[model samples]
Target: MDWIVITVLFFILGLSAILIIGTLVSLPQVGDERKNLIKMKAQSYTFAVAMGYVLIQLFKNIYNGSNEGINPFTFLITISIIYLISLLFFRKKYGS
Candidate 1:
């Protein structure tokens, strides 16, 4: 198997586990308001980034005149990784 495939799979699995754990166990020290802010901001950014990624992929495919399709899992993992990082950033920035 190619290293790229292996790396992508590893990241998808590892990030998923971290996301699930993060969701199940909310940060201990943050207040509800701050947590909400963090979630909302992260989600907003994730949405924008995901849409941009889609557009870029669409344009690339069109320009290349290829029939290739975007991998849904790859898209999910990309933006979820972004969301998770943004979540951590906001948590630290707004955290006590």
Candidate 2:
């Protein structure tokens, strides 16, 4: 609930929006199969990144014995940022 966290969340969310919108606008009309493949690859990469972040946070919390707890909003924002970046990466890497 800190102001810094809130600010960061908004900033990252804005970046995500820009990336998604820019990618959508810039992308050429591709086939559905290609689109689906890009999406699948992005999602797979995002899932792995999300799991890694969560596990690291979990262990850090346990090891530190802190009651600060994990911030759900931060987690969501992190995942969204990762997913968007991954999506864009795949699109650019595989686009014709």
Candidate 3:
């Protein structure tokens, strides 16, 4: 397998895992108002970044080569799972 592929997978998995774990573990210690703020900020940023990635992928596909890379489906799935878990964890804590 390509080292680039390995590196990308590791990067995505490590960051998503850390974010999910940190959010879940810290929820109990955060106040309700702060939790709400955190949730809003996280969800918005996650969505924005994910969308930006999708747009980049779109253009990459259209451009063909020069910046060729792996399909982003895996990244999308990882992002969705992490963001969903974060939202659920926050809702459970904040009574949303």
Best by lDDT: 2
Q: Write the per-residue lDDT of candidate 2 for residues 1-96, one digit (tens) a residue.
A: 689878988898788778777776676576878777888898899999888887888899889997576677777777887888888888888888
Cα-based lDDT at residue 24, candidate 2: 62
**Model 2 ranges off by over 4 Å:** 1-8, 21-26
Q: For residues 1-96, write the lDDT of model 1, one tens digit per residue.
A: 689897877788686768846752675444777767777887798889888988999999999999898887667677767878877777677665
What TM-score against the true fold does each predicted structure earn? 0.74, 0.73, 0.49
Position 4, candidate 1: lDDT: 88
Which stretches of candidate 3 lie above 4 Å from their native place?
1-19, 28-30, 65-96
Count of backbone clashes, every candidate in sequence: 0, 0, 0
- The whole-model lDDT of each prediction reads 0.76, 0.81, 0.70
lDDT accuracy of residue 72 in candidate 2:
79
Which candidate order results from sorting by lDDT in descending order? Answer: 2, 1, 3
All candidates in order of TM-score, best leading: 1, 2, 3
lDDT of 3 by residue, 16-79 (tens): 6776776656665547676666678669867887788778887887787566665665876567
Residue 90 in model 3: lDDT: 55
